[model samples]
Target chain A: MRLSENRPSPRVRAGRELPLSGKDLLGLLSEVLAKGVRIRFRASGYSMSPFIRDGDVITVRPCKKTDLRKGAVAAYVRPMNGHLAVHRIVGGTEAGFALKGDHEPIADYPVAASGIIGVVDRVERNGRRVRLGIGPEKGLVAALSARGLITWAFRAFGRNKGSVT
Target chain B: MTDRTGLDRIFKPSEEIVAREIEGELIIVPLTAGIGDIEDELFTFNASGRAIWKGLDGRKPLKAIIGELAAQFEGDPEEIEEDVLGLVEELVKRRIVVEVV
Candidate 1:
């Protein structure tokens, strides 16, 4: 029998090193609006798992600074480059929200809050919409939505130890 | 504290460096170095910060930048100066730009 492939294959912090461009930005925003607010996207890794998986297509919408809400999943595109990141919001003020991987215990940072493109509206799997609420850990999308809990559990297990990071 | 001497105060945008347009706002890649290391980084500005950034034309002195700004906006130059300097300072601290000569 052939050996199985390793898990967590591509752990990218943002996106491929490719420069994100205006066209790319437009491409990302276009996914919304099936009509108007649009966005562009790409996918990799299982960091968000069960909710967003490896090979899952992420839809990005160019969001107004005002559109973001606490606990919403958001994509952040920086000024100097076009790479992107998707994370959950735990804390935020009227200004912006703080971000972190659901599986990780530590808070990463607060994104500009204003530059947020769009919150993840839904996830598509093999042409099917999995009908998921943002944080549930059952509806395929929501199952993994439990987030940092599983990663934290995995860490507590020490099956891999500090190596998990 | 953000660096004072690093920013040229007169930043000129070129093809390589550009403003990031998102959510009806613009963010410029300051002429600093390796500012892209921190992933998921997002910086925002209030209305006044936006005005100060637009004033950066690579010719105006930091002081003058505030004066030109005070005329259109409501704050006193002395007060706005602090905010202006602070914004530029933080931008510099992030390695977004070097103080121009």
Candidate 2:
């Protein structure tokens, strides 16, 4: 599957708005979350493809560290850059937890329970909204993400979709 | 009635408002409704707004804040007071700024 597939296309400018860097946006997100806020933003990138499209809007809620389980999708701070990263919790380690992008093969640096910002609760796609929680779909996705096979599945789905024309 | 110009009244940032500084820019988010909803709009400030926000310590009076701002920038005290008062009034209306007893 092409990397840019399912991405939001560039649109014409309506008016000039102050530009915010990714770091600034994440910092703002963290600040609001600290204040017990729930936030949503249009998804970007292909890290969690098929499950979460680039233009899909996601709603995240503050959650307890213990609430997260393997195969759950979460937003966390990357230890290396202190930036926000959204990925699936494939498994856990003695240090903390192991997280990986659904589209990437490698697991990211293990993040402490405190490093997690929130858990995704809802995703809106094509005017339809779906709530995410412990369920069969979550379990299956978790299993696939844990084994690093989600990318392959996504690729297969993409090829099949492309051939449908 | 309390004198509005008195420097004795304390003015503090409302607990309902949360703010942060990133890359020299001030970002203000209001959490009055218990939590900040990302769907709500956010307020961002540049250099001038930063200057005014930094002066909102609960201990400082409105007059004193105006003086400090006037000394820091080249604007006349009258103009500064007008601008500061306008912004502070808006903040008060939004509950982003509160008066201390």
Q: Which candidate should be chosen as best, given lDDT against the real structure?
A: 2
Give each prediction's DockQ, rounded to 2 decimals.
0.02, 0.14
Residue-level lDDT of model 1, residues B13-101, one tens digit each, is 33223256554745332222312211133344555666666666667768777777667666455666766777666655554444555
- Each model's TM-score, in the order given? 0.38, 0.75
Error at A78, model 1, angstroms: 5.5
Interface RMSD of 2: 15.5
Worst 10-residue stretch by lDDT in candidate 1 chain A? A1-10
> What is the iRMS for every candidate structure?
19.8, 15.5
B-chain TM-score for every candidate? 0.67, 0.83
lDDT of 2 by residue, A8-79 (tens): 111111111335566766776787677787776666777877677676777777888666888778889999
Instruction: Report the lDDT tens digits of candidate 1 across residue range A1-165.
Output: 101111101122242334545454434343332233433234565555545665565554445555565556677654335455666666666555665555545555556755555666566666566444364533332223334465555466564465333
